[model samples]
Target: MKELIVLTFAVPLLMAFLLPTISRVSFTLSKLIAPLVLLALAIMVVCIWNFHTETFVLHIGNFIGPQGIVFYVDRLALLFAFAIFAMTLLMWPWYFEKDESSDTRTRKLSLTLLLVAASAGMSLSGDIFNLYVFYELLAVASYGLIAAGNKKPAGNSYAAAFRYLMISALGSVFALLGIALIYFQTGTLNLAHLSEMKELLNNPAGLIAFVFILLGFGVKAELFPVNSWVPEAYMASSKRVAGLLAGLVSKLAVLVIIKALVLIYPQDEARQLLLFLGIAGVIVGEFSAMKAQDMTRMLSWSSIAQLGLVFIAFSIPGKAGMLAGLAVALHHLISKPAMFLIAERWGGSLQNLKGRAQSSPIMAALLILFALSMVGIPPLPGFWVKFLLLSGLSAQQAWLAIAVVLIMTVVETNYLYRVISSLYSRDEQQSVTSRHRTADTFSALILAGVLIFVSVQVQTVGQALDEIAQDAVDVKSYIDLSLGGGS
Candidate 1:
């Protein structure tokens, strides 16, 4: 079971390596490998779902902690890994839907596979430096994936991709500086080791490093101010590519940031900084998304806003905050991808929704279901998840931020409902585009089905998340488990 963790990521990476050669021999074989790899990885992650009862580290080459790379997998990490593979699997069938030559499709497959491996690796990384390596890996893969959409006749894909790459590269430098500062202070890069260095962390230098790291990852997480790339990148890219960036990459980045927060235990001032960012993100993202003309840009802003709430949820101290963060991340993971899938298949604009219910009822159903879930109506997983986030804030007397999030949620609801309302308008213009049911439709339906499943199993999922949160707060346990059998 432990071995599955390594293989979960390694499989796609292996496929990526062999793909070019295989393409020369059989292009069809290359195109077929990605979905199969993703499907297998999803199965392995599910198999190990209930297997993690303790947080432990897997050292490469049998090397001791802080001396080499180590993989970390607690329930939180496992949950993110599971979500990444699951979402990617759903997007698999639609990947080749766009008509591209064999070589182009094969290259896209390789990069997409690389992104999968990077995301899975990021979730399991046990050291801050190793985590950065995977972070850069994720960024590189994303640049390629985003650029692939540019290969089409028209769009701003290249410009968006270039902006993302430049900004991301600059951000990585800050992150590297932060890692260096931490290493300079503590002489260790292991997260467990960093947890033991409280003296350094609470100091001025440590505080500076914390800021660097947070804002650094902020670029990827689409957190406010740093997330200018969100709309452009999503808008310029293909639906499948947009879905992967918005749904999987950003969420995995959030998980990685959460992991760092758990291990580092930043100062109160730092937490406050993050809390403030959350407030701004929610308000600004919702408002901006509301104003956007296109569904893709609108959903992009909405994603930034929702992730802001995630930041707020996790920023709260102790197990409650951790639990809130998990719920928010999980909820966004389920809903955002489906919404993007809809946007991809059906055009994503206010007008695009017009008469959609009549012209493309099946896709309409998928959009409506996901949109309702996102707005947090009762009995859906989102409602329960959001309840946990606000409850945590209210308990902490974080009233100001709580009020802003709730108010912005209403605005968020309005725009989404506006889109929904347009779906059934009698005078709305009907699109001439043919609505043939394809892999995109099936993939979205599968995601919607998962949302329904989650609604029914809410209690079971909550209990599991609670356990992960508990482990997340117990920094000592992570240290002991990883460094327990010390030299």
Candidate 2:
């Protein structure tokens, strides 16, 4: 089982290398391989779930020595890995169908696989250095995918990708410097060992290291201050790539931030800093999103806000907050991708959705479902996450935090309602009643099915998230499970 954890990261990476060669044989064959890869991953995730008793770790080649890297699989990693697999499955077909250019299509597919591999690597990585490596891998692959379309848009893609790369490089430098400082202080890069030696990091050097790493990971996670690159990048990338970026890549980055907080930082001041930044993110992201008109742009801004909420929940310093963060994280992971897909099909503006529900009711319904989920409507998993967050905030006497959340919620509701209202309105002025209802219906139905499934099974899903959050908070359990020699 431990060895299988390594395979989860390795397989997609291996496939990404081989995909171009396989594409030369037949494009259809290459496309066929993607879902199979996702299926295999999904199967492994299920197997992990069925057999899960505690956290586990695998060093490549079973190399438990100081020289080799380790891949740790806890419920937290598994949960995110499962999300990557499921969203990839949902995304692949649409991406391929829309992308008819063979070269671009092939590159897109390869990048997608690479993105998955990197995300898996980040999730499973037990060391700060390994996390940085995976983060770079994800970033480079995203650059390629964003630029894999028509030359006009590709130029925008290049500019966005370049800016992203530059900012990311700066972040990486900071992270590397931090990692170096930590190693100097503790003589090891293993997160578990670092946690054990937390007392050694009580100095200014360690605090500086923490700040650098937090900024590095926070930028990628779309946290405030450093998140200026996100909307433009999403707006510039092809819709499918946008979906991947929004739904998978950014979430993985945020997950890494959470992991670092849980495993590497045990200081109360650090936790307080995280809380302060998170509250600021919620306010900034929501207010910014409220001003956006383009659907894709709106979603991008909304993602920033949603990430802020996730960070806020995680920063609350308790089991309840961690659990709430996990729930919200998972909910957004599912719904945001679906919303991006809908945006792709329905043009990029809310105005264009006028009479969309009348034309393609199914697509409109799915859009509404995802939008409502984002707004935390009843019986949806998103609602429960908010419920948990509000409950946790009230308990902490954080009235300011509560007020910020309320303001963001109202802003979110207004914008999401605009989309919904446009969809059902009788005004046909902005709509083009097309004969391509089949395509629209098919796309919408798939997303709708997923939204409904997640909604109905919220408790079962929430329990899984709770387990993951518990594993996340249990640092001792993580160390014991990862390095316990399988006895």
Candidate 3:
């Protein structure tokens, strides 16, 4: 099991480098290998989730101290590892235009593999150094993927990528500064060690370090004040790339923040800071989405709002916070990606979508289901997710947050209803000429199926998420498993 945990990241990292060479030999064979490797890793994660429900630690190279690399594997980590592989596999750029070069295809494939490797590593790493390394790798892969999304040489994707690159680089600097401060104070970078020395980080300097780290990571998590890149990047990139960024990568980034919060900086000031930013993010995202003219940008802004909701849930503290955050994160994971897939064919000015349902009824129905789920209609997973969040906020007496969330839901429903109305309008002069690709629709259906299945089993899923939350917040268990009694 330990070896498998290592293999989750290691194998993909190795395969990413080897893929170009493999393509030199047989292009077809190279294509087969990436998905095969991802499938194997996904299966491994599922098995671990079933059989090794207990939390464990892997010390790479049998190195047992703060000097060595460590991977802490709990059910929460395993679930995210599985999501990285599964989502990457689903969003893999399998289709290319007839004029598209073989080199472009290979480059995209290699970068996707690198992204999977980095995302998995970020989820499992037990030390700050490796997390930073993985985070940088994730950023590089994302930049390349976004820049390569559009086929035209002078496409707007480059401008979007450049903007994203600048913001991400700045964030990286802040994160590094935070890590240096941490190391300067503790002489150690291991998370378990940091948790044991929380008092040392409870001071003002330590608080500053936490803030720097949060803002750094917040760039990718779509946290406010650093998320200006979201709409531009999503609009410029392909639907698949946008979906991957929104549904998978952002959640992993949030995982990094939550891990830090639970392990190193369990303080009210930290939580409150997160809450304030989350509220601003929700306000900005929902209103901007409501005003968006295009489907792609609207979904992008909606993603930002959903992540804001995620941050809000996590800010509540303890198991309730964890449970609510997980529910919102996972639910958004399913619905947002599927919406992006639908937008593959339906993209453009909302005015252009008038009467699209007359042409693509199945996709229209799917869109309605997703929008309803996102708006928190009863019996849907999104409803229960919001219920958990509201319950948690109510318990904490966060009346302002409760009010903001409710108001935002109304704002969200208004925008979504407009899109639906456009799709189903009775305009006889509708200009939509293309239907959703069969392959894209099939991929979206799988995610939709998961959403529906979870809806029916909401109770079981909620209980399971609650259990994972309990395990996640058990700080002593994490420290003991990682450091072996801090010996």
Task: Output the number of the TM-score-best candidate.
Answer: 3
Cand. 3 Cα-lDDT: 0.91
Ranking by lDDT: 3, 1, 2
Worst-scoring 10-residue span by lDDT in model 1: 91-100
Candidate of highest lDDT? 3
lDDT of 1 by residue, 1-487 (tens): 6766898788889999889889999987777767887887788887787675556678867787667777877887787788788788777634454577778877888888888899988888888898899899889988988877744546578988999898888889988998899899999998888888766778889888887888788888988878988888888777777887777888877876777777785568877888999889999899998998888889999999998998999889989998898788878877887788778755545776677678778877777788777888889888888899889999999999889978987998899888878877775344676674577778788888889998999899788778778887888788887776542
Off by over 4 Å in 1: 93-99, 150-155, 428-430
Steric clash pairs (candidate 2): none
Tell me the whole-model lDDT of each prediction, alpha carbons only. Answer: 0.82, 0.77, 0.91
lDDT of 3 by residue, 1-487 (tens): 5457788888998998998899999889999999999999999889888888678888887889778888999989999999888888888888876877777788889999999999999999999988999999999999999998764547689999999999999999999999999888888999998999988989999999999999999999999999999999988888898999999999989998999999999999999999999999999999999999999999999999999999999999999999999999999988999999999987679999999898889888999999999999988898999999999999999999999999999999999999999888788775747977787888888998998999998888878888999999999988888888332
Writing each residue's lDDT as its tens digit, candidate 2 over 256-299 gives 77777787777777777777888888888777777887888888
lDDT of 2: 0.77
Q: Between candidates 1 and 2, which one is better according to TM-score?
A: 1
| Best-to-worst ranking by TM-score | 3, 1, 2
Query: How much is the lDDT of residue 171 in candidate 3?
Result: 96
